[model samples]
Target chain A: MGTLYEDRLAEHIGKECPPIEAVDTVCPETIRHWIEIMEDRNPAYSDAEWAAGSRFGSIVAPGAMMQVWSMAPHWPQRDLPELPIAPVDEVLISEGFTDVVATEQSQQIHKLAKIGEPVTFTVKLTKVSDREHKTRLGVAYFVTFEYRFTDPRGDLLGTQSFTYMRYRPEPESESADEPAA
Target chain B: MPTDWMKPHLKYDSVAWEDVSEGDELPTHVREIDTSLVVLGAISAARDFYPVHHDKDAAIAAGAPDVFLNILTTNGLMASFVTNWCGPDWDVTDISLRLLIPAFPGLKLTTTGTVARKYEEDGRQMLDVEFGAGTDYGPHCKGTATLRRP
Candidate 1:
């Protein structure tokens, strides 16, 4: 509705933040849990004996789990820093555009994560819509971030570009100048 | 329980890179979408805390019919589809995804793909597979995945 939020988002474009490491290193337990839920039965991901004979020579984390390895932890309430995009989302929320949804993602994998390796990620705001984009739900702004995932040795494992649509719901009735309580 | 007890019984053979053709078709993989997939996939698997992915009321309020699959899980499923077809030795080098519709509970998700290109890059045999997943409501997601042969 105003240029304030757009100006705020523009300032963040192309800004990269410090890399954040995963709370836990890549481990077998988490990999098992993920493939179990997805019903992925690939022997290289689950069977130790089979993977030992396979080209990998050991169990490997699923290539698709690249982002999962760096996802923020939920429980125990550790004192982790906020992602670089938190402030950008705050700027949008301040203007009543609170809801957000992932609309697209693209990943480039240089290497799959291996067991016992610590994964870290650095994120940069890549793009922001110059104007409001109208969608089925409501008028919105699209924000995109690029994430680079790397191993402890600083070797890149993968890269992902994630895009989210942030929007406010349309009012059912035409009400103007509604007072804030 | 011992990890040995967790191993699944092997059923399929690996696809060798030497035999892959540009027009080769991958076997279709079908999954039943339910509450467990939508919830556990978001929370325990993908570690996504986004309310719309796990909370039904929150999803409705956010303009979704119900709790839907998160992007990471969707990508994971797509990866599984490719690996399941190509077997255990190959490496997936890239995945590009475009979301069209929500994969909701009660829908049967089916993925099908074709090898779009077969070539050698930097002495590594590579295959680019164009894949798409859909349900009764039409296509849900589509993408191209690049696989490196071992």
Candidate 2:
């Protein structure tokens, strides 16, 4: 709704954000914890017996847990990287779309991850919707990022494309029938 | 527990691609999106430090009545909904879901899928499944998953 958004914000599409930090080699402890929380004891994930009998022939991390390796940390660290996604979000929030919500996510699980294989990810801000859309929440724009997961040998483990809607919520008018934003 | 007819055979705990055809239906799985999973399963596991996920106050400030489910958790649950039926041998190559409802605590998200199209591609046995998940807020996610069956 402002000149800044029309003139400057639209210029951010196709921008390349910084790469996420490399993680230490993948370990079973982290995968075990995730499996415990989701209660997804799919023998492939936890039961040694199931995995050994399965096609993989060994324990494999849940493909959905691919994001845990790259998301924001639970605690703030002084040496935290600049968060490759900051500029994309900060620019939107600066435009008065203070409310943010995950709108869609698409992931491709290429190869099942084996325990002890290292994983790292790099993200690129692919698109920032140029058009303003309205929803029950308010006015918003969509932000999309593509992530590539890799192992130490630079082999791709998987890939995910996530999109979020950044909007200014009008909580007073929450309605299910409201038009799409 | 699954019966003998449902158990996986040999090395793959899944249905063979030859046995499945287009228009086949997938079983529905109803999973709870409770407080613990929202806070512990979704946020803690993903290490998403956003207070909006753990702190109710922060979530309220973010225009949410309570802490809500995160995408990572939803992805996991949705994938499971499919794999749980396909068996451990099936491969989920692509899963795309769009969030329409904010899954709040105490809400149970039920998932249902229909085999939309089954075909061969790139030397792989593949099928496209259309899936949807719903809460009281209406459909929370609508998406498609592409899978390879052995």
Residue-level lDDT of model 2, residues A1-181, one tens digit each, is 4565567665665555455554545556777667656655356766666677778777778788887777554455435545445776887777788887888898988877787776777787777777777677787788888888877677787988888888887755554433332
DockQ of each: 0.45, 0.42
In candidate 1, position A4 carries an lDDT of 63
The sequence of per-residue lDDT tens digits that candidate 1 reaches over residues A34-96 is 988877778777787777787777777887888887777777775655666888899888878
Q: Best TM-score goes to which candidate?
A: 1
Clashing pairs in model 1, backbone N/Cα/C closer than 3 A = none
* Cα error, candidate 2, residue B43 (Å): 2.7
Q: Give the candidate number with the greatest DockQ.
A: 1
